[model samples]
Target: MNTIEEEVPLGRRRRRRYSVEFKAQVVAACQGPGVSLAAIALHHQLNANLLRRWVEQAEGNERFLVARSEVSVPSAATPAFVSLPLETRNARTGEIRVEVRRADQSITVSWPTSEAAQCAAWLREWLA
Candidate 1:
């Protein structure tokens, strides 16, 4: 009875309230390039987890949805890296040689650094 009486005076602590504009600013900082959400939260003396929730809420907003809908999403299946066989000649000579192997078939091509685009196009054509 005494403990209840004592607790009644303190009651529950009030929850912290933040303005929408402040939340939007923090969320925007989290989205900036090379910006860390935890660092931002620490700088602002806020909980990182709370900032992440705000980010989720912002992303789910109708404004974000409309902007996201305008951007094209790539296919889930990304292109695999092709095995690029490298051959090096003498160190004195700076030349590039790329070899591709498919089952029993193999191809060898040598190109100067300046003609890399042509070499890439030729490789693509040959592979196709």
Candidate 2:
């Protein structure tokens, strides 16, 4: 008599545990500016969406969330900088200025500040 082996469900596949340092590295790279989530995921041979989910979990922890909220929270004493307008006119001259704005003031710099704002938005949305 021939016997057929039962197929295991996809969800039952073994779950892998990443090292703390490795996970931190992935999170750091994900948090870094000008680095696309897709690129980071691809560099690690992972799905972009999965890395995104991991980011959500990491940011959800109480301590981290609180710390982030402090920086992003719109307070009477603080201003919220939403985004950095990309300067296309001076692309050839490398004259892009990263606009850091709050409710009260704004400053321009040579590097992009979108990373912090984007991360805050992601966390806020997750919380909501």
Candidate 3:
């Protein structure tokens, strides 16, 4: 007693649109030296793996890093440290701070005293 109409399905996919400016920025960040792809991707909330693919595709292009100096790091007397401020997890008596070396990217966790050593270690390992 009921009549039904036939349904149709479109098998085509939609094309995504990206601005030229965005593509240029991505390309620049990918090729820029002294900056990690991880950091760039993190800033843009993009996947590092995908950004690496873009870099690979852009390799040998005019925009690529033609000079070796762009990627070289000079030796310094003191290692640069980056303060990675840690949020207090609990109401503890001691304080902890995580720092990463800008020169070598090494991470170091410091505590106020020996009593906080365990907490510092945990933060270091967990952050790593």
Candidate 4:
């Protein structure tokens, strides 16, 4: 890891310059199956964000592509939305009922469904 440590001004942190070979090696490790970028960064004593940038940059470089081809890369798949079934509720006589129970005491309150927003606000305030 041929890093050159140059002197910096006061209040400024020293910047590290990693060799091209070292960056390529780290980036290749990140491309492995089931590999964690964070784990690789921690293992190499590198910032996670900096390692991420190296991987991104390596994706566009031919040298990295050749190295990546040596490993089996997973195919990227497009994400699909799944529809969920919603529970049906009766519209007639619609009401919101809440039960509050404390030690040795319980209270049940029914509020009109039309005032659900106000009911939510009241519950928030009461709970807080």
Model 3 lDDT tens row, 1-128? 11113333568654434343444456566564466889878887667886786677556555443432243433324446889988565337454656767876787755765557687567778879
Residues 4-107, model 4: lDDT tens digits:
44546788676777766567677877865677999989998999999998898888788766765665544535457889987545345698888889999999
Residue pairs in candidate 2 whose N, alpha carbon or C atoms collide under 3 angstroms: 79-102, 79-103
Q: Estimate each model's TM-score.
A: 0.41, 0.37, 0.33, 0.43
The global C-alpha lDDT for each of the candidates, from Candidate 1 onward, is: 0.68, 0.61, 0.58, 0.77
Give the runs in model 2 whose Cα sits over 4 Å from its true position. 1-13, 62-128
Q: Identify the leading candidate in terms of TM-score.
A: 4
Best candidate, lDDT-wise? Answer: 4
lDDT of 1 by residue, 26-111 (tens): 67666655678899899888899988988898887977545444544432354568999775562346556888889999987678
Residue 76, model 1: lDDT of 33
- Pick by TM-score: 3 or 4, better one: 4
Q: Write the per-residue lDDT of candidate 2 for residues 40-106, one digit (tens) a residue.
A: 7898877788789868877877654444444432222335588988956645654445566799999
lDDT for model 4, please: 0.77
- Winner by TM-score between candidate 2 and candidate 1: 1
Please give the RMSD to the true structure for each candidate, in Å: 15.2, 20.8, 17.5, 8.6
Regions of model 3 farther than 4 Å from truth: 1-17, 61-128
Q: In angstroms, how far off is 115's CA in candidate 1?
A: 28
Query: Which ten-residue region of model 2 has the weakest summed lDDT?
Result: 69-78
The per-residue C-alpha lDDT of model 4 at residue 85 equals 82
